[model samples]
Target: MTTQLFVPKFRVDECLAQVKECLEKGWTGMGFKTVEIEDRWKEYTGLPHAHFLSSATAGLHLAFEVLKRKHGWQDGDEVISTSLTFVSTNHAIKYAGLTPVFADVDKYLCLDPEAILDKITTRTRAVVFVGLGGNTGQLDKVAQICKEKGIALVLDAAHMAGTRYRGKHIGYNADVTVFSFQAVKNMPTADSGMICFKEQSDDELARKLTWLGINKDTYARTAAQGAYKWKYDVEDLGFKYHGNSIMAGLALVSLKYLDNDNSYRRQISKWYRDELNGVEGIEIVPVAEGCESSTHLLQLRLERRDGLLVFLNEKGVYPGVHYTDNSEYEMYKDCGQCKNSVKASNEIISLPMHVGLSKNEVDKVSCLVKEFLKG
Candidate 1:
């Protein structure tokens, strides 16, 4: 395809080097590399704990379950969140037997805190805020609301691998923060995610819950001086959600160069801003105050967005939408309806975004966008 939606460029030397080490060791199954990745993630964010999972969805579900256990969650409990996010966020809520209460989004495409203010009811126990398009839209306000109401602030930071708010990482702000290292994400790792909890106790619980509710992970188990044993306990109903060694190796290699790669992505976004500044009928999303985003996905809100998308495709620019309304999905047809969400979903379109996309490619795409608007 002439227009690639997302192309994750790997440093072959770095990845192959790690692979060589793993091959030499001949023990590649969610052990040393996984621990290293988690340690590096913790170091990068200055967080006390980190757990790597098979995917961001897995991390979210595990986080939800941990929250449910810590707070005694029950069926029909409500989690206030934005409708502009991917359905997986709501799916996590559903999987935990809790309801997702949809809230409207502001200009940043992240959840609107004021809208959240209006929606808080007696049954609302948590606010699952998605850092949509890597923007932390009024997250501070969301945090304040959650704290004042004693509601858990769960963050679905799928697009924000390296995002920061006021010099602090997104994970530091929310009670529990989950990051996706999916194939298309800035920090690609085949597929993996990191879940960090605010409290050590919750972190302890999450570790068990992600690994079949076993108190000791395989890595810890193998460290015993005598008898590498199979003796285990299923303290809480858990799932097999741990990230394997291969994915963790990739994540470790990628995490080392994440900031460098993101600088390129940021430059591409800046190029878009410079090249398409003041294009009629096209609006570029702005940076949220005090937020430095990873810019994983560049989303546009434009008039005749569908037409623009078609035009881009014809010109060999295979851009896509970040998401459609969850309520439109048959499985989630019963999801809370927000008229603004429908409007936002229709108007928003995702442009080509990745570190491998050259500045010249970004300029070409930017020109195509302007030409489409002219048409």
Candidate 2:
């Protein structure tokens, strides 16, 4: 059997039950359950406002775009971003007509505060912080810096479904936080996300912007008693980024078990930490202090990362690389080198991590890693 890098576990029966209601009720679009899930998400994260979207990518785009228009950011204004994340993190900055200044990542594969300070310029409007593999390394420091500098903070929390920092949920401190519920994420939906903002006004604007700038969503219209209720106006240029009720159904079911699933993932991470402790030529990435990460991935740094992946593959175990340096991409080549991110890009590997993985499977995978290194 192949030991996959990530195998998402879903509660099929419960999910089906949720979806059944959507199918039976004849109301499966942008309302009802989606609203329920949004409320639940607010309860879960303790953020003031939440808006469900088609994907985290959409949420990311809106995070920058909403703030940019609201703040009147110029076309070429800058947003400092880590070069060690998925392309969507930087791409969203571009979509908002803002430049993404690539910053270096730290040992924990998160944006380094010092690097952020170096990249900030007069036009710098916001900082996009990615909690890589759910680790919040130096995030509090980064948050403090953003606050001190009076810049906005947009947290790319795709891996941070249930992550917490300093005894509170991770999204509270951020100006805007986006969470992924993509099929393979900790919370498994077909593909959806939640964007949370600190201000209710921003959240209301997001609702209008997500549904093609319509002031009222269909659900709101449907709830009205008179014909005039259906009459509405578009206020701003928006996109069809609203999430469907079917996906919301899945999210609602998955949300029930997110904390439980993340706990098991952390256990798997701890097992790998114990099994790989003191091993030569391998360095486990460290989690931040006061952070209870979602443990979305188990990452390690070592030489010959590709070679190790090949060896693991031959043994029916499959690991994967989280990302390449975003600066290496054609669109970002001019951003100059992010030295630490470049180095980490070459050496980091994501070991198999997910709730479906068993402890025995983790042990076997760890032993193979040890055997390959010793050879």
Candidate 3:
């Protein structure tokens, strides 16, 4: 069988059962299970607050918009970000009318703190740090810098559903953090995310903004006693970005098994490292020290990445690329200053990473990689 890049593993019965609850209740849109998942997420992460959203992209945009409004930031204010990420990370900045100042990445393929310092100017209002492949490269340092400079730190933790630093879940230090529960993410929900804010006020604002600026959600309105409970004034112009009960039901089930699944993913990563380490012409990306990564992706850097990818495809071993440098895109062409990001973008390959893969499958993929490198 051909090894694909990501194959999400879901507990079919459990997922169906969760969905059944939503179906039987006759309510599945933006309430009930959505609220439960939000509570569960907060409990799981120990974050100050968690708000369910339609996608991480929405959460990211909300983070910037809320922060921008809260701090009275101008339209042209800058937000430092890495180019080696999915375009959603940068697009969210643009959605909030902020300029994305590209920063270089470290060996972990995460934003480099030193590079972030270089990008900061008076107009710099925030830094959106991506914990690529669940590795927290210098995030502590980055947080410290943001604190000292009085700039907001928005962690684009799309790959960091269960990532932890120093035995504590991430997002504790950042001003705001967003996590993806997309279909193929470590936690496989159809398409949903959790936005965590350090302060309660921000979380409250995000809730209103996510549901089209209504102070009270449908769920809250339904639960209230008197008349006028249904009367909610539009606090601000907002987007239809709130998550639904159906997606939240899936997230609820996924969150239950996340730790166990991540442990297995780490084991798979270890197997790959054992097979690929010390192989000439290949460099396995290193996880940051003290970070128990969710093992979202096992990325590697090699000079012959494109050729090897083609070879692997021919061999029925399908790997993938985490990203191409955002600066290479026409919309972001003018922001292309990070040399390391451009180079790494050319070299990085995300090997097959998912819960369903067996040890033999990993060996098969690793052997294919080694075989191609030998030629």
Off by over 4 Å in 3: none
Q: For residue 9, what is the lDDT in candidate 2?
A: 81
| Per-residue C-alpha lDDT of model 3 across residues 17-92, encoded as one tens digit per residue | 9889889999989887888998999899999799999999999999999999899999989999999999999999
Q: Is candidate 1 or candidate 3 better by TM-score?
A: 3
Per-model TM against the reference: 0.97, 0.99, 0.99
TM-score of 3: 0.99
How many angstroms is residue 131 displaced in model 1 relative to the true structure, after the best TM-score fit?
A: 0.7
Candidate with more favorable, higher lDDT: 2 or 3: 3
Error of 3 at 316 (Å): 1.0
lDDT per model vs. reference: 0.85, 0.92, 0.93
Clashing pairs in 1: 30-245
Q: How far is candidate 3 from the true structure (C-alpha RMSD, Å)?
A: 0.9
- The candidate with the higher TM-score, 1 or 2, is 2
